[model samples]
Each structure stands twice: as C-alpha cells, then as structure tokens.
Target: MSTTAERDPGKTQAWGAHAPTGLAGWVIRICHALPGTSRIWYRLTRLLRGPIKRAPVRPFDVNALGMELRLLNRGNFCEMTALYAPQFYDVPELDWLAAQLADGGTFVDIGGNIGLYSLAMAHRLGSRISIHTVEPDAELSARMRFNAEHNGLSINLAPVALSDHEGIATLKIDARQRGQNSLQDGTANGQADTREVPVNTLLALCQSRDITRIRAMKIDVEGHEPRILGHFFDNAPETLWPEALLIEHVHDDNRLMQRLIDALGYVEQGRTSRNLLLSRASTTGG
Candidate 1:
C-alpha cells in the first residue's frame, strides 16, 4: 500500500526504543559537539538508511510546559537543527512560545508541522484550552497525533491542507522542508513524490464548526500566507476574530503584511525574529 509508515500507529517509534537512547537520539543530542565534517558525515549516513526504519524517541520534554514531545527520526534531526543551529528561528521566540499557558481559550495552529509549538502550548496550558492544529503532510500529521496523545492532550488534529478553499491541490515535498511549515518551492525544480490534498479555508472551518473565539493563532504556510490572509479577511464572519496572531512572513513583502493587518483591524504587537505578531485593534468599531 502507501508505505503505511505515516499512518501506522504501531510504527510510531520512540527515541528511547533504539540506543541507550538510540543512534538517532544520540545523534540529535550530541550533534552540536561534532565537527562540521562529522555532522555532514553523520547526516548523510543516516539519510542513506532510508526513511527511518525505527524512529528515535527523543522526548523534548519542555519542563516549563509539563509536556513530553516525541519526534521521529526526521523530526528529531530537525529539532537538533532548530535547538542548536538555530535555523529559520531564534531561541527567544522558542522560549516565549513555550512559556505561554492559557486558562480556557482556543488556539489555532495552521501549518503546525510537527506540534512543536502546539504540543508545548497544550502541555503548559490547562486541559481546558482547546487546541486546533492543522497540518497537510501525512507523515508529519501522524507524528503530531502521536505527540498530542503522548502528552495527554486532546487537540483537534486536521490532516488536510488549509487554504481559502476546500479542494485538492498539489503539495511539493523537499528534503530541506524545515518545520511543519515546510513546503516545496512550488517551482519546476522542486522534488518528487509531491502529492495533492483537499484544502479547507479557515473561515469555512470556523463557520461550519462554530469556532467563536480564537485566543491565539499561528500561521506558517510557506509563501501562501497572503492568500490565506486574504481569504480570512474576505470570509471571516463577525463572530470569529482572534485576539492575538503570529504569522511567518518569509517573502519580505512588507506591504502585503501591512495590508493584511489593516484589513483584519489588527495593529502590530511585536516581532519574534522571523515572525510578526499582531493584536486585534483595541478600538475597532466593535
């Protein structure tokens, strides 16, 4: 069949299952200590083994959040890069997102990738807060589910891709795709085995599901943020307005970002290195 690696729960290998930890786990923990050549050599060797026969159970137990995160080989390796090498994001932002705890609110994480922030929030916050995480990649979605369950949190996991519409679209897969927000370049030179999925707009989802209050929101849709933001503004009903928003602006299109903020009646709050934070206008017409 379809390899089933992404769908089989029994295949969800933990980091501790392999080494004293495991080879993958140790590779992740001591990755930073190794020299540049050694790091390259290690990753190449691991990659050649082909699609993680057994996933390493690297538990990124964020003590502050009271949750344990389980990552597969690919995710654990990326975590190493994010934690030690600091690619695409910084440490301060990671620390800030990890520290947040909600009493009883709605947190929507679009392009949540592998539950890095979603799991952290679910763990730190009380069980009252409802988490809605959407990820398109099957392999990553399966692992996200595993992490949520492992942490004893109930997140409404949607495996379908998110967009302004509800239909199928092609998804490019690149080995370099980092984080859950990873997407293929969407160009002719992209990688292979790229697939498509039915997409659902946030507005439609909220309208259909009766999502009234959005306490916090995070969007990391590669380069499709503008399209998503446009649709959100165009179709967002009166009842659904998020209090705080965090989105990645990888394109450097400041004008578009500003326009999106203005359309949504939100003012700039702050920036977390790579992402911009916006808050609902304190004095919107209401």
Candidate 2:
C-alpha cells in the first residue's frame, strides 16, 4: 500500500524547480492579474501551436489555493486555465465544498485532474481530514503526486477510473485538451487517443479505504457521470453518501441524474456554471 508520494519521490523536486521566467513570466503575471487575459493567451497558443510548442518555458509554477502547482500549458486545459485564473477557477464550487466540510471528514475527488480540488481541501483542512483523489491518467496522476508532495499535503491517490462495473475500460484521451479525456465513447470533439484503464465501483473504492461517511465529493468524469453515480446511489447506504455533492452536469442534458439524486433524498443547493450542488436532506436540513 505505497502512497503516490512514496512511489514518485523525486518528481516534486525535479518539476517544482522550474518557474516561469522572462517574457513568459511577465505574460503569466498579466494573466494572473487580469483573468480574462488567460483566455486570450489560450487562444493565442492554439493559433500559434507551432511556435508555442517549441517554446522553452512550457511548465510554469504558480501558488494556487495555497498549493504550489507546476502547470503544463500546452496539452492540459485544466492546468492552463488554473495557471492564469487561479482565483476565479471554480471559486463558487470550492467555497461551497469548503463550507460543507468545515468540520473535517473524508473528501473524495473523482476524475481529479492534477488534484486541484483535493490539494485545495488538503491545504484548507490540514491533517484533520482525509482526502482521496481518483485519476486514471498517468501523467496527470504523476503531476498530482508531485503537487501534493510539493505542498506538504497528505492525500490518498487512486490511479483508477470509477464506473458501474469493475474491469478494464477504454479511456478516450483528447490529444489537444487533456481535461476532455473521458471514459464515454463518441464524446471526443477532436482527435482522441485511447488507452485501457482499470475501473472500479465507487462503493468498492470507499470500502477499500474503510470509509463509512463522506463529507463532500466532487465528480467530473465527463459524460460518464450518470453511470458511476447512479450505481453508487443505488447500492450504497445513506450513511455512506456524501453530505455535500458537487457534480459536473454540463454533459447531462436530460437532467435524469438530477432527478435521480432528488429521488434519493438529496436536494439541490444551487448550480454553478459547470456543476450542480446538492446536499442530503437529513444532513443539511433541506
């Protein structure tokens, strides 16, 4: 049961050494100051892919949510967006989650891209709480390990995807945008590479950690949200459910999942631009 930090002992030291410099540093500072500039920078990078690809400084270090993040600006969309607009990145959702788990408990991050949410919670709650981050992407998981180590945070990292059934599943990797990588088929908008990743059920994951209750959980598994969540709610007991749930509902057009959550005694707290916030009625007095 070796931890992610234990497995990659040198990644933090190696990657954390590089920081943005010169023109890149200046541009990054501007983007951080004016969040809107991040979109312009992203578009410009997309337009001038050849030149940006050959740029010397690709990975830039930034302090985000009290954690030091070494972001790769070229392929990963999450890192690039956070690199510039860290302040505004999921501010509302993160705030809501923090408030919900203020007393300290287990927090699970499903489809954790580079451990932003998990790292943020770890930094905020400290050793009073346990954090578990599940990510199937090899590179992103490695980066997440580096980030946790660099920030001096302890988190349980599970490098496995969660689905309705347990086995190997095809994860479609969006080459141009790593954040768009998904387990759902035919969801890729651009050129996608596929890889076979190990899959497990959410209940099994919790059981493996001996977790009986969860304070909050954030799940952003692209289009595969319904499959994972539906199965979990159907099989898991109410005590095992998270008191607060932040689910990415951008791809859920029919809102079937919302109805399912409501039927399971979870009331909608609110909605952000990309996620729907829900809390259990018994726990939150909904």
Candidate 3:
C-alpha cells in the first residue's frame, strides 16, 4: 500500500496548511472544554456548508476517547462529524464498547472507515489488547494506517470486505460520502464508480488471525450485516463468538438482523442512534 504522502503530495501539504491552529485550534479546544458547544459548532458548520465545502480539506486535532487524533474535515462524514463534534460523536456507544474490554481481549472493527473506534480502543486499552480494523477502500484504509502510525499505535489492518462467501465483489463508492460505500450489487441509483474488493467470511478472518476469543466487535458493513453475521453465526464455533457486539442497525430492514441475533443467544442490551448494542446471553445474564 502506498503511503498517503506518496499517493497525494497535495494532501500531504494540505495537512500542514490545515493543521488546527490559531482560531481554528481555539474553537476546537473550546468545543471540547464546554459541553454542548461542539453541537453548536456542528450547527454552524451546517449553516456554512457552502464555504466549508469549497475550502480545501482541513485537519482538526482533538482528544477523542483519550486519544489525540487528526481528523479530516471533508468527503468522509464520519471524520467530518468527529472533527466538528468529538464530544458527542457516538459517546454512549463508544463508552459501552470500551467498557466491554476493561479486562483485556481482542476487538474487531468491520468497515472501520478511518479507524475511529479501533484507535479509541487501542488508546484506552493501551498494550493490554489487540485491535483488527477491516476496511476495503484503498484511500480510507491508507488513511487508517496513517492515523495509527501517526499516533504510534499498533493495529492490524485487513484491506478487504467480509461477506458470506470468499471471492471478489463490487463495492459502490460514494466519493462525497465515503462511509456510505457498500458491497451490494447494481448501480440503478447511478453510482457508476465502483471497485472490486476481495471478500472473506468472518470465520475465515478469525481463523487466519488465530483469533479464537473476541471480547467485543463492531460491524458497520452498510446493509450487508445480515449476510455476514448470519454466516458467522452458522459456521463459527461458540468459543469464537464475541462477548459483545455493536451492530449498525440503521441499514437493517424491519429489524431482521436484530431478530436473527436474538435467535442466536445474543440479547439486545441497548440501542444507540445508529447501532444496536448486544451481548451474549451468558455474558449479560440474559
């Protein structure tokens, strides 16, 4: 994989030019220091979308989940939202997921994007745990690697999409919204740009890495969750199951995946705005 600096010299320069400094640095600090201010700043960003979009991609440095992260301010919604409101970006879900690894174990982040969840767990758990972040997008995966190396954190990155079968598949890329990229077929919506990414099942990934015990896992594979999780539940041994799971429920239809999880001995512990928090029945006293 090519380094970010090698792939885009201009982006490397933008990193220096857009470093959170002076007024921008002050605003970010204030947002972190004062509760609700981040939301206010987010609202302002929405109000000034035109100028913000027209400006070059900026970088914002902030302490999120106890880790100092340099987040990009354009293209990717996850990074942009985190840049604007680190304080409120999935705080409850992150807290709950982080708490599950208090004792120390492996954490897996599917569709990791820019490694927000994986990096946070690494920072919080330090050397006590291992992290595996899976992202197929070449650019996003490179950014994730850059962020991990930038922070001097160790994270195993798998640049492939996980599905029910092992093969090559088409991934729809929404350049403007990188997080919305998916493995589903057809471009009826006119999303012409697509990439062919390698696909593997969850069991294959865990087996290859010798990951027999997972403390927690967060999977956000757009709308392909059901296929992946269903295959894992059917093929993986009980010992290989994660104690806790944070599954993105926004893409689920009629709560189909939630019902499947329930049938597999996982109980819903809670629900965030975008994810359904679940724990193995034995672990959660369900």
Candidate 1 per-residue lDDT, tens place, 1-286, comes to 2334334534346633423234534544454344444346456444433433244322332112244444333333444343333222234454444333234678888887776777767766747678888888777777677767766777888777776667777676553443534433233243355766667788877766678888778888777777776788777764576776777766656466777576667877668646876667862222
| Per-residue lDDT of candidate 3, residues 1-286 (tens digit) | 3334324423343234445666566655555555644466557555444444445655555566566566665778788767766666788788898788888999999999989999888877889889999998887787677667767889999998898899888888776788998896432354466888888899999999999999999999888888888889899998998899998888877465656565777888899778888898889842
Candidate 1 lDDT for residue 50 = 44
Candidate 3: residue 94 lDDT (0-100): 84
Q: Show model 2 residue runs off by greater than 4 Å.
A: 1-16, 35-57, 184-192
Which window of 10 residues has the lowest lDDT sum in candidate 1? 56-65
lDDT of each: 0.59, 0.77, 0.77
Question: How far does residue 14 in candidate 1 sit from its true spot (Å)?
Answer: 5.7
Instruction: Compute the lDDT of residue 166 as modeled in candidate 1.
Output: 73
Better of 1 and 3 by TM-score: 3
Clashing residue pairs in candidate 3, if any? none
For candidate 3, what is the lDDT?
0.77
Query: Model 3, stretches more than 4 Å misplaced?
Result: 1-17, 21-30, 36-50, 60-64, 185-192
